[model samples]
Target: MSPLLRYPTVDELATRAAALVTRRPRDARLERVGTSRAGNPLLLLSVGHGSRHALVVAGPHANEPVGGGTVLRLAERALADPALTENADATLNLLLCLDPDGLRRNEGWLHGPYTLGRHFRHFFRPGFLEQPEWLPDGADAVTLPETRALLDLQDELRPLLQCSLHGVDVGGGFVELTHDLPGLPQRVAHTARRLGVPLELGPYDTLYWPSLGPAVYRIPPPRRGDLAAAITEAAVESTWFHPYRHGTVTAVVEAPMWGVRAVQDGSPCADPTAVLRTVSGTLRRDTQLLERISARIRPHVAAAPDAERLLAPVDDYLLVCPGLADTWDPDTDDGPHPLPPLGSAHLAALRISGRRLALRTAGLLHQLVTAAGSDPADALPELDRLLDAWCADYLDGCGARWIPVARQVEYQSRVVLDALALTARRADSLSGEPDWGSQAAVPMHRE
Candidate 1:
């Protein structure tokens, strides 16, 4: 347990950030961006004196709060050495945590007895449609106050660079960029290696997305009205970084909570079909388990006063996801070449995603059970026991191990610093100036 993993709650983060800003009254200042849907303050720390500005955002998703630590550390580093940013002509603006309401929901396991069981027990992620990172479509009048606040800041600042810090539940780390800048991928890979975090080479979340390198991918801006498509399209389109399209040069660091060597292996399989079967088989098993839990809990949920609100979303997610598993057809060859080997990271991601869905369904069921005033003495505990046992089995099967919080923070921060330095170098080269030899030379982009 690294001291870095002493994950702070929303209140604690606000308090600590305020103190840090107060100490450097002349250089650093804190501002209230807006309030979350739950009314927690969305705060930002402004550091350094320069014409160029960079915005660093974290905690976009409740489950991926590792970025909160990274941003906080960066804020402290910038304040301690004003020369760090002043020389680069870059001002650092840090949004400590974006989704404070969602973050509080995950705080139960933030300060760990950090075990897989405890983490899953306390997990809570909103549906794709409800996530703050995804901007609402025109047809849907839904809008999150947090999203509006961040968008307002981006429009006002039009930052030269924007970095969104994120992390995974398992497997190695990866990077996502808004556009391809020369040598940026190599810098990202080198930073990960130096920090001892393996880069995930397996097909996971980015299976269908375009790749820039082994674990680096580009995030395409959503076309107009694309959010009105399927849930997947809408989810991808909701990325907050996309709206800053005026050459903002966005970067996302997705480190993992735990990693294994299997995640990095990309060797070809003699029987690619068998690999697909294995992956599909895992999803099937997870789906069946969730279906079983849902069946048992449905009766109680239906009897609850707010039954429609509790049951509809959980039922919808389960329906779409389990069917998605059946869509994996290795026998069909639609591509120019043979199917690639199913990487360990892909398998881990599949299993983890399924488990999260099941846990989320169980959580919803628990709420319904409690709300209905029904005696859930047996059903809720059974659901938890089954889910925990399944997670333990999955971990054993995948060979997953714990990663220290300090290491994750270190890797994420280093990547951001390296990227900022690279951007500065690019700006200098374009201006016909020589490299300043330090990250301090990195300048924020001019409008």
Candidate 2:
């Protein structure tokens, strides 16, 4: 168990961030930027004295926390290396954790030994709307309290770049860009390759989106059929989509909580439809199982304090996603090439997505059932064991292993550092000044 693999608690992160500013008081200061929906303070640490500003946010999704560690460590880097900060020439505005209310719920397993078993035992992911930094579908008029804090800062400062650090349950590393800056995709590929993290060649969530490069996808201006899946999600707007001032180009970095070798297997499948059948089967089975659980607990759901919020994910899974899966046909895609034949990796990624969705549904539903307490509460322990067994079997079948939090942090921070250098170079080029070159100028920051 490496210390890097152990995620810091929200309080501990705030304490350590404060200490960083205290030690380098002249260059850094910590302030409460805003409050969470649950009343937890959102701490933003401002580091360095650069003309431009770069906003780095982490923990936008409660379960994906590689960015939280990256934010803390990157703050330290900004304080210690003057040239690194001078080149990017931007103040590092670090939001240590964007969704503290949701993250606090996942702290049970964040403390260490990041095994699938422990994760299944302590897993908790709030519904899309309940997780911060999202606006409900067709309700762009609203902003989450946590997201409002970021928007307020973004509007006032208009930073040069914004980074949303995220991680996956299990898959390869990938990057999403709001703006297609030159040389960034190369930097991401090099970083993941050097760190032994496989790049995500498999596309599921990124499906139908344009690729900026290998494993790198452009987020906005959704490609054809993108919103078909978007409509199923309650809050589809993440942090990156909110920034506009200074044309704050955003980059979302994602790494896997556990590394799965299959994500990189892009070889052809003998019978691709067979893989789709497996995916369709898994989705229906998982949905039916959860529906049974819901039927048992329905009598008490209305009494729960957070019933509406907790039920959103279950409703989406039971009503929307499974319906699509049931009628989905490989022939539905009238593209130049067939859909399912995209290969084994694509199929594997689809299965991984389904399994993750099931886990999310089960995690949130159990919370709702427990809070609404009745005889259904007694059924939770057995339900948990069933999920645990499912997870254990899937982990083995997929050949997945725990990924150290350190590698994930390193990949994300290095990408930010290089992006800073590259963006600066582009700015200099426009001003008729010589290119500052890449991170090769700064030995300490190269991947």
Candidate 3:
């Protein structure tokens, strides 16, 4: 068993990971990849002799932590799995917690002897300007020690695969990023299946509306230079999109730990011994398939027009690039307070524009419930209701906004209702019965 998983704490996790690297009997080495704004070391555990390397990072966002645990667990497992540790064809290096200060804020939950409810509540805070992870120094932009560390490490490591383990809401499903890595999606799907998590697909755009898509979208047209079009300018500033700017071509997987408890029945096997069998199996399959596909396409990465186009789907995330919503001012509580309840008009528009995506997302949740060997019909509606209420409270109460945040509430309400209905229908079809005996099973799907 890994020593770190024995006790959970932000400090303990980092210390244990560092200790593991220090004590590694393998030929690999431990190095400092980056430092948090608070000066916490972003350590990298590097193993293998292959030129092809994969970088795994977690804790990019303070609230989302499954990746931190995953990286630690993966490191310990790799130590014993010769196939993972003895790789001569590729190397795997992990960046555990890019934002240690943000991580520090959530230490109570990580090393918790607390109840699950308290742990979850205590750790769930949003990323704001004050967060060490988001605020880099002005002008240079990359001045944030953590960002600099990662940039420097990327230069030094030149990883071919980079997976940042992240989770969405308590209601999220697993998803992977990147157009590269052959059979990458399948591996992600398979891993989620083994873990009893679901995959999110569909209109995630609504989640990033007016910032990324057909909804008043503004992505800073692919280039820089001119404010207006000229008749015959000597130099033309063309707009271009660099997908790599925000994401990596390296294989990236977003693992949702939202339903992790359901998937593995709340298994407390945080240690290498308990989790090694699963991690090794998943990694072996993922690597074998990913390598085969990558080998076939290695020659084309350079020639691919609009290199960013390849990353479109995976790069799309609400948290990556947020909307133009105002941040909550800590100094003054004078902002959009007492958010209006979601309106009917906004709800209608969201339903029309976001139905498909909502359905797809719902399908992912359904998959999670079913994969856990739980009756989807029995579990999904309850999950949907819980998520809806949670979203409502989150959008409305988390912080004061000048603009009514109720639109988000309404959007989520409609989304939750629709999801519940859709999941019920799908579960019925699979089970060949339309019976959900509980009265609570029925959602307020009418609206």
Candidate 4:
């Protein structure tokens, strides 16, 4: 296997975007789209002019660096092969990085080896108010300027397709769509298999959303809400509002960062109840860790408003845990499967891995607080030791390993192209235009 790869630093990423702009001024314009709470300018790179538009937003979360490469690939591809974007009728309105501040904070891991240890050590994700993608729109919500910028762009563009490219720290590769299109599932699955990547046939982030087939899915209705939405009336990314408002086909791509074969192994589990217990146990332990750390650092977090912002995930997770679906009951059948298409045991273990990854932000905050001299009693070392063990368990127990940067980007690019083609074909058919032969059709494979 190829060794894990590092992504360009934030400065290098900006230079690359600038290069793309200079390469095809007629086709591309890199402009400031919005501003982060930290006053960083959020940029949007627009390339090509096609019949329909596909808006690709990346870097919604701090650690998921794969999308930056994917966006660059698609933009350069459009500049090089005009027909590629034309055939898909996609103008390629791309948000290179929505969270520049977050990206800079994650630069330690971003421009280094994408290992689990490095990630947890340098982890940093903002609270609901700080996250642009999940910023709330309701009266009580404090909407970040970046969130407003995205909503404004959506209104102005009214895009035909929107893709928020993301990466998962573990488990299988999967895609979620706001509107299901014919043939997408097969395409996504075939692409994953082509790369020797496991499809997320088991439960993961989009647990409540209905799957179309295999790893492809139609995102849950906007009314259903999410972890952020639970805290705010209108969580930006969770509801997937583009589909309903603009008639856009919104998609979220999760390329796995680590893998265990069992993530895709579908078989009848010898015991279903045991799997559920294991899942519940992990959740219980994670929640307990969050509680201990948050309680220990609550005063410091309150004293230092910045610390409060850092502890948002821990706070929000605790706030919403009672309603969160991490607790699965065997008799309830509240998961993808009790057996087959991923046996209960394997899928349940996946739940453990996801929780571990999610709670890492809390652990990171613990480290931050202790390092800052907030804990007079040095409450963090004992907790940090336990956290170290959990991280080890995640890496060793789940068979965590690097998913090369190139492979991850390629998988995302393939899926986005396939989706663009499907949407473009639909546009042609809906227009009642006479078939322009090959132009009217999008081949599943490259010519």
In model 2, what is the error at residue 329, expressed in angstroms?
4.2
Compare the candidates by TM-score and give the number of the best one.
2
- Poorest lDDT segment (10 consecutive residues) of candidate 4: 434-443
Worst 10 residues of 2 by lDDT: 331-340
TM-score of 1: 0.86
TM-scores across all candidates? Answer: 0.86, 0.89, 0.48, 0.86
lDDT values, one for every candidate: 0.70, 0.72, 0.39, 0.68
Higher-scoring candidate on lDDT, 3 or 4: 4
Can you rank all candidates by lDDT, best first? 2, 1, 4, 3
- Stretch of 10 with least lDDT, candidate 1: 226-235
**What value does the lDDT take at residue 281 in candidate 3?**
36
lDDT for model 2, on a 0 to 1 scale?
0.72
Residue pairs in collision within model 1: 88-440, 134-238, 424-442
Q: After superposition, how far is residue 426 of candidate 1 from its true place, in Å?
A: 3.3
Question: What digit string (tens of lDDT, one per residue) describes model 2 on residues 1-447?
Answer: 444667777998888888887798888899999999889999999987676777888898887877888888888887787765655455778999988987887887898666776675566666655656665442245557787787788887787778888888888888777777777778777887788787777657676567787788777642223443554432256556666536777777787778887887878889877777777677778778888887777776778876876677677666655655654335344223234336777777777877877776777666676777665446587568767866875688777777778887887788777776776566666678643333565433443
Cα lDDT of model 3 overall? 0.39
Estimate the lDDT of model 1.
Answer: 0.70
Q: How many residue pairs clash in each candidate?
A: 3, 0, 12, 1
On TM-score, the stronger of 1 and 4 is: 4
- Candidate 1 local lDDT, 158-233, one digit each (tens): 7777888888877788877776656666776777776677778753566666788778887766655432233443
